[model samples]
Target: MLRFLIIAIGAPLFLMAMPAHGFARLTIDADSQYRYAQSRLDSGAVDEAVAEFNRFIHFFPADPRVPQARFQTGVAHFRAGRYQAAAAIFNQQTVGFAGSPLDNQAFFMLSRSHARQGMIEQAIVDLHNLEALSSSTDVIDQVRYELGWLHVDQGRWNAADQAFNRISPDNRDRFQVANLKQSLALSGAIPFKHPTTAGFLSIVPGGGQLYTSRYQDAATAFLINAGLIWAAWESFDNEQYALGSMISFVGFGFYAGNIYGAVSSAHKYNRDQINAYRERLNQHRQISLSLAPSPKGAALCLTISF
Candidate 1:
């Protein structure tokens, strides 16, 4: 028979009275590994902390602490701004270890990770799940706030209102959430910059932007274009056209970025407006499903078709 020796946490250090006490059995030195990992973490050596914890997990694959180790690993990745890594780890834990003690926290973290990565729709789904899973008042409050923010970002004012309204008084004091709610209450969006001007500028080397009302884009186009103008002027004035030419070449890059930004913003604005319009076209469907009898205790069955 294969014997597995395990070092359990919080277990009594009593001498074993086995007939054959020797190094013949496989021993799991978890205590030492845990201590070393804890020491590294306390020392602020994050890389070493991961290394030690990884070793601990490798040595004790089936230990009860595995879930905790997984959570810590995800946390470490999150602290490092490795959001994709954190999301993957958290997602795996949430799906693979549903009943783990850290599942709620992991799901919350996964939502946050997706938010940071701008996976807005995915973030909303996870946030919704987190809200449902949260038992703590504070977490519930945060879920409402983040849910509101997600809807706001997507330009769903009615949905945003619903989410924001769910915020508890106790959590209303948070600056970020309060500010967002206040802004949303006052105006559904930050500011309405005319996408026409932005788009026009892009279409006509910044002229369209000026017409559409994108002053910033107009300025960028006008300012960045000086290279060609300067080059021509320099060549005309002092015959040192090479410097002006090089500067103009660099100016082309700035012009390109500005144009791209203007065009992108314009299209995004159009999409937003279209979405708003389409939202108004939504129709409500109601279907009622209930058991009813024409006569008391009669054996009657009915099916309604829509």
Candidate 2:
């Protein structure tokens, strides 16, 4: 009686699980499944596309298209701004699918993922790794171009110029790189105000702020210092010696602060100009990679407009 009760209780649970197990085993056309996932991705339904691609990968793990599906999944995540997820997928593709046709692409995408998340130092390290491993002229040029932009973002102007200079003369982006180099050359003309000069000029109580083009702050500093000095002089003229001394002490504090603030404003002005120049240098920077098959073999084609 006990054995019969146990079998009856287990039978329904086993039956309920069987259909799901069997459905996973059902024969499906791998191409059609991959196409469905691709269609979802193409329609801009990123979340649904991720789900469908995951489904295809789950059902057709052995299909040749599985690698491409995985790559597309990473692309979908990247497009959705889910950079960490995309990085993981691309990183895994580089390792798990070693020697596969998409290896270089996976590595590049991994670096891109890191870059998008502001992990710039890590991204640079990854790009250096990619550059060292790649033998293709086109791929190397593309990597250097990206490296240049990364350096520009970090304010490493000399490093950026070096990277851009490494691109071959025959490459299509040479003109664009020349334009970038021209921009870098103009960086010196961005109207830098020396902090020391600002401090020295502040002896006149707002001269430094004027030098830095902070008109309103210059006016305010001038008024405050002038008022304090006038108060001290008036107190001394009235024969209030103690009050005059106190006023002079207060005026000195304001005068010293004016000098410090002027120096700080000069530094800030320089930073603002550098930041604006960096933005200009970065305006046209974009990199894309596509795999193309030739009669001899497959190669990665990297294209950059600037």
How many clashes does each candidate structure show, in the order listed?
6, 0
* Candidate 2 global CA lDDT score: 0.83
Tens-digit per-residue lDDT, 1-306, candidate 1: 123244442233434534255336756587777667757765766667677778888989877666666666676676677889889988988875343336666776788788878898999899887777667776677667667656765677678777867888775655244555454565444344465566555655666556545578677777666545566577647766686566666767766766777766666656665455434422111121222121123212121211
Query: Compared with the true structure, what per-residue lDDT tens digits does model 2 show for residues 169-212?
Result: 87746438878888888766788899999999999999999999
Worst 10 residues of 1 by lDDT: 283-292
Q: Which stretches of candidate 1 lie over 4 Å from their true place?
A: 1-32, 38-47, 61-64, 96-101, 151-158, 174-179, 188-190, 197-306
Report per-prediction Cα RMSD to one decimal.
16.8, 6.3
**TM-score for each prediction?**
0.51, 0.75
Model 2: CA > 4 A from native: 1-33, 96-101, 172-175, 235-257, 283-289, 292-306
Top candidate by TM-score: 2
